[model samples]
Target: MQRAQRNSLRLLQWMMAASLALPVALFVIAATISYTSTNDIADREIERTLDVAHEHALKVFETIDRSLAELNEVVRNLSDDTIRAREPALHRRLKRLTDSLPQLKSAWIFDADGKALVNSLASPPPALSFTDRDYFYSHIDQSIGTFIGMPLTPRPPYQGARFFSVSRRRDSDDGNFIGVIQASVLPEYFESFYARIGSDPGSFFAMGRADGAVLAHFPRLNHDLRLDPGGPVGQQIAGQPERGLMTIAWPSDGIERRIGYRRIAEYPIYVSAGLETSAIRARWFATMGQHLVFGIPATALLFLLLAFAFRRTQHLQAEAAARREAEDALKHSQRLEALGQLTGGVAHDFNNLLTVIRASVDLLNRPQLTEERRQRYITAIADAVARAAKLTSQLLAFARRQTLKPEVFDVGQRMQSLHDMLATLLGPAIEIVTRLSAEPCLVNADAGQFETALINMATNARDAMQGKGRVIFEVETATTIPDTPAPVSGNQGFVRVTVRDTGIGIPAARLGRIFEPFFTTKQVGHGTGLGLSQVFGFARQSGGEVTVTSEVGQGSTFSLYLPRVPPDLRSQRLAPNTAPAVAGSGMSVLVVEDNIELANFAADGLTELGYNITLVDNATDALAELIVDANRFDVVLSDVVMPGMTGLDLAQAVRDRGIGVPVVLTTGYSQALSQDGAAGFDLVQKPYSIEELSRVLHRAARLRRVRDGAAE
Candidate 1:
């Protein structure tokens, strides 16, 4: 009886051991199956994403190409010699063309002599010549369907922005080539398009042009993310025509991700999609856990019947999960790398603008003037200085360097006040029209800045007309919602003020850069190219935007959109105050300036104004004159930028020598000299009318007297 009982116990122990081992083996098999399934899904998702991204990218490229084609067609039709000779009508057509296609910067017809017959910009330069351009030479063949020129800076009547020119030869019925029709397109158009791909939160997209130029991206990466086609991924990209999945470390973010990249076969750009490794693994892990639960029970039965099947399933799951995670990480990195390159380029251009403003201001203060014309000279000098100050302010705003001071006001009323001034400024040749809304349109903005912007727009319109054309000013109000179609490109809800002109229209080529500072189509002395730039800065600073539309001949329109302001906060209008005059007790003054003609003119004006004047060309001579007889000079008036010493330096020197005379610095460029550190000195800007100069001098004299009295 004892032996039989022991045998039963041993049998039971063996059975229990088998039950536990079978389940463990089955669980391993199930986990392997789950990982394989998850990997397959991940691969399929990657392929789909890549395919979709490529298709979308191609669509964008095609749209741009179509726009370019339309512009080329317009250029071809307008380049005829007969059409060129017809002034006003030919100009109107060109304006219409540019107005219809806002993307074009500027368009023009170059006659056989390389003279511009028509230009869409404000004023086509006199004696304009472009016979030496590569596009003109290449188009001479006439066989090239459409000649696309490399990126270059456009010559006058167009400035501030770089553009690529598209040209086609225009021929008469006799197969004789007349001229080349060329259109300019801004690089920013491509940048704007690429910015709209997707908002996948943690995920980002990127595109690279054929020449290894990183075009666009999402989640704004820093400058270091540029992808070099000579690099590993770039090499891989070159080799593959179809969609691909790979693991890559994006140079910009330095994060490893699973990446899917596809070359846009029809276009010159490559599109990429990226997924984080953590995201992929987390998804796979969840799927694997669920599979393990079911697989363990099933595998236990299978292990009892077949042990080899369970071992194979376990191995497959582990391998699949690792592969998927690696691929996703690589794609994310590449996209970021491409984005960094584009941002860097934009930053570099912005810095260049700052440099130009700084240099121009320093040069303005070098010229000399006389006492009588000092006030007029000072007013002209002040105008330029003020613009320079505005430029720095814009940079600060763009960089988020300054705090905003927004206020509420009626946009319509403000525009109405500007209309009278615009009418006077645009002149008789250009008909001025107003289409203001009857109901008031409120907006939040800086009133003084807004007025300046309005004036700038009016001036731009006047230039577009070349002293003859029609300018239509209109204002309207509307509420905006998310995803709604914007009235202008890259804009949202705001008050829209449209300034349209029937002058020479902007070409599609030069349309994008009209707002860039120093990018002007006017002759060098005719315009500073800062008009639209100031408008852009003011709009942006006030939480608004400025968009432009133009055609080569049809015309150009600028639309300013400002955020709506509540009624209660509008600024009260202040009456213009008359400037107080300085009560000089027949004191002698010293005037220093480098330009002889201006200096002589100023001295004559001051003599007429009953002031005794001693003129010098620079700060050194003025100081010498003062040292020879300190009592001879009541005040030292000097231009800021000079060869020997700056105006500020001279002022400091005079103070150190115990000369108690007042110093007034005059300049054309004020950006460098208007900072807080340089604020104590009196300033007068260049290009001022005679009356304006007198006002500033009087104020300076009065301030000096007050200071002198306080010292006594």
Candidate 2:
């Protein structure tokens, strides 16, 4: 009997191992599979990214190549000053080219002895030397095709300046080396273009020569052009494959990178899109994290299930059954609580958003609305829609693709605009106080986000005071980091905003977690716990920081720090929104949207603007329309989120098929878009007005022209 009992126990133990560890092992395998699959997908994405970088690089190279070809044509028109009347036309053309392509720094002609004949520079050089230049030496045979040269820093009036020139060898009728037409490109343009590519933090995209000269990189701000082709980067890419993926560490900052590199077929250059291994690993682990949450519990449950199934021998037994049950119950309770919290937030915020939108709609329907009042109503409606979309996006945890539109704005003016809005939002019980800077605090930030941050701070203050105490809002200028007990910077100035509330102050320990998501001191159902988190994130993302101070009984002060740009150096990017809209004038528009109401809205909008519309349900249909007769449409306007295929896929399809129609993608909130973001296609965020749409369409048409003209 004793031997039989021992055999049964051993059998049960093996059964338990098979039940529990099998699932666990399967989970590990599944996770590994997921990681590998995700990596492959990421590599595919890297290919798209490489293509984009390649396109941007090609724009410059093609521009220079085309300019050289045209310069040759103009020289043919010249014929040794007998047709010198065309000289003025040639200079005008070069100037126009410079204007059209910002990257084309200067275009000039040289004599046989390497003396300047004509220059596109504002202050033209009377004479210039190319005797020592590679572009000159390489083209000594006076070849026709374009020749690229190593970067050079010329001396004199343009001192300490560096540029790369693409030159075409000009020759005599006898095929003797005469001179060259060179178009110098400012490398800074690469940095500018790269910045606009909008790669994530710590990720970099670069365009360089196959020999590994880094033309430009992002977050590499305001530095003199640096070029070293013989460096490590050069050694890795120089004379490398036409396309490849490699692991490398840049000497500038020794961060390991998985680089996706492709050599441009049109030019002797390569483009690299690098994502750090840490980021990739983070994404992989995050996927595994989700699986583990469900996988471990399921595995343990299997163990319990197997034990219960084989109860006859009393063979299988759960050692920590009680403990595990409690843990499972706790996890279940936590998940329910989280679900309830999320649902409540969605319900409450949606109600508020709906109320705002409904009110705006009612106002917009006013019969006797003045033009000014009509504009205000329209603006209000757009704002409400944007707010509603943002709230919904937050519920879905979708990231926003649109960046902060930082511009110089007077804080005093903004405060005046907010006064009435705050008064209404905070209600009657809270006493409002504004202590603004006397010398008009000018700040650089997304005006809308800044306003939202202020309102959030005010809302928190009102809540803390239980709607019955004073809430003080102050804006001041500071030359140091705010409230940091330690020195963090070397006198970097900030436009500081402080929100002080007279309320039940926070405890010493709990103060540390105030900004954490879903952490709130308020009673259940009263708070979504994301208010302060938004403010904190916005501040940090705007190249600033936030700090807080509280005494148990003395109330709390939340201070937000935003970097201050010097008045003289502030970017002049704030264009007036009064540009006259161009009527479509029977121009054909293709509308691709899944939402019937949104499609109708777009169709009606274009119709009002005097355009013909062809509506499609999804990307597939849109592609079909384009494939059938792409020239039938001037622009394709599509919603991002659709059933069959997304707007991004459609835009990509349009490009892939080599269709020449300009595509405009519009979106409210899409997780896919928030992550991968808009490809080179123009993106007009939801809640845009007819005027905004017009502007983007105009811009898109211009871009299409530039792209097609380049192709030709």
Candidate 3:
């Protein structure tokens, strides 16, 4: 019996050691995998940053080169005396070009003697000599296509700004070098762009000459720092001369970083992007910390449970029941707490929002308010109205029931227009970068909703980042969506608008339900959780899709995919209507609405527009009037939802009774409109301006008149 007991004790010891070893081994493997993945992601991000810089540099250089070529073509055969004589015309041309391209600060034409003949900076030309300028000297002896020189800060009489010169060697008909034509490129342009793309602690973007002269750097250095000719990056550029990546300690700060460098095509310029190695490792550690937080506790709990079972085997059944009971009670308490928090969160947000309008109204009611204060109160009321409207629109959008008037528009062009607006809305603290595709991204979507969706995403990004970060809008054409299970049909292409933000990202466990209305990860009263749902619904209603990808501490990317409108269909749209006469000239109209105030308002508004109006409270009475004499009214206007019969049903009955008067419908929200969509009739959304209503009604009336005339 003693021997048996000793053996059992030894077996239990071995079991405990195996259980502990398994968890430790699994954890080690997980950590290794996590570290490798984190580094790989960081490397890709660095490469992408390099690509952006490279593309930007290439575009700017190409523009400068083209401008130079144009100048050469004009002056290659003209003598120095003729060019000098025509300096006035040339200066105007240069000014126009500079004005057209924001990248250029100025343009200049220098003679063989290195004397400036024409420039965009001043009316005629500054009494400046280019003999000592690097751009002029570099091209004097070489047949280079374009010589991009180092950055220089100009002296007095010129703007105290830094810019780099891009020049080409001007040659005569006989291939003899004559002079140099150069454009001054604003370094602030590139620096501003760099600031938008990356905003991390040790992020850097640098452009330099092949000979290691620094042209520009973002997070601009106080003093110039050139790349070492013998350094890893410089040596690679010297050898390969196209593109490369390396890890090295920066000479300026001795900080180790992973850098990616690329040469602008056939130009002696290079753009390099670097991210600190320590930053990358810190990100890795953050990821590992999350894992450890969950894993260590879980493993300890399992071990404790196993030891308890071994020590108290005889009492295991009773303890198991007690443990299960405690878990149930805890889970019940958590559920109640979560529900209460969510309910309170929604109520708190709405109440706070309402206070703005309420306070403004109370202030405006005061008798002795000053004009300035009264105006301020009025402005406050307007702003509150707009916010309330936005909130309602968001909820309606999430419900997929908002009335949408879709039209074919270029998505890229729209994005370009929003650049300024987004910059203003996001404020100075956040940078907005856009990488719009040159190719047309035409989609049939509601323009207003499209803007709203983008704004929602940007606002969410701002919150996630704590109001200060980078938001990048990248638009491109794609045939396949990466996160989808299967590719969309090949015949139909998609315009993918990606909004990427550097923010504390959504947790993986919560990503699946991000589009569920009222489900949010934000703190209480911060959000209603309807923003992403709006995006999801708009994409779906427009026959598109939305997807997202994120890492815990890295950031999130929300991709909105919309179907590209076919070229043939775009061409088939009807021509714009001829500007109609504003005066209704006694054209009769019947208005049907459920609300008495709305009916009277429409009647009064239409009468002002010179249209005679017959108003009714319900569609049933409106139909009786229309059936009496269809020709009495030029058009029938009705609301979609009414007491007995809907406006849509009334229109259908008008047709069934052989009444020929055209019918127009209006609604703030309706299931019929959402599902059937206007039903082959003109529609005007409710709360529409009088101008919009007049135009829509006039169009319908004119169309009816034409139909009657054709029949006659």
lDDT of each: 0.65, 0.74, 0.83
Q: Total backbone clashes of model 1? A: 75
Residue by residue across 600-649, what tens digits does model 2's lDDT show?
88778878998788988888988988988888988889888888788888
Lowest lDDT sum, 10 consecutive residues, model 2, at 393-402
Clashing pairs in 2: none
Q: What is the per-residue lDDT of model 1 for residues 1-712, given as tens digits with 9 covering 90 to 100?
A: 3355445445544555666766666656765776677657666766676676677656644544565456446555554455545645656656666676655676666777777777566443365778888668787766575555656676765576666565667675576777776777655554454354444333546666566655455545444245777887777776775666777777677666677877786555577877666666677787777776777676567545434433443355446556657866875784466346435533454455556555545555557745555565555555555555665554443333323334567777777777777878888777888898887677766676678778888888888778898888899875652343443423325788888988788888888667655567887457656567778877765666778888877888888888765545656553223453333446577888888887788777766666677889888878887778877776777887788777778888888898777787777544346332344666655544345555556666677779889989
lDDT of 3 at 661: 89
In each prediction, how many residue pairs overlap at the backbone (N, C-alpha, C within less than 3 A)?
75, 0, 0
C-alpha lDDT of residue 651 in model 1? 81
Task: After the best TM-score superposition of candidate 1, give how far the Cα of residue 78 lies from its true spot, in angstroms.
Answer: 99
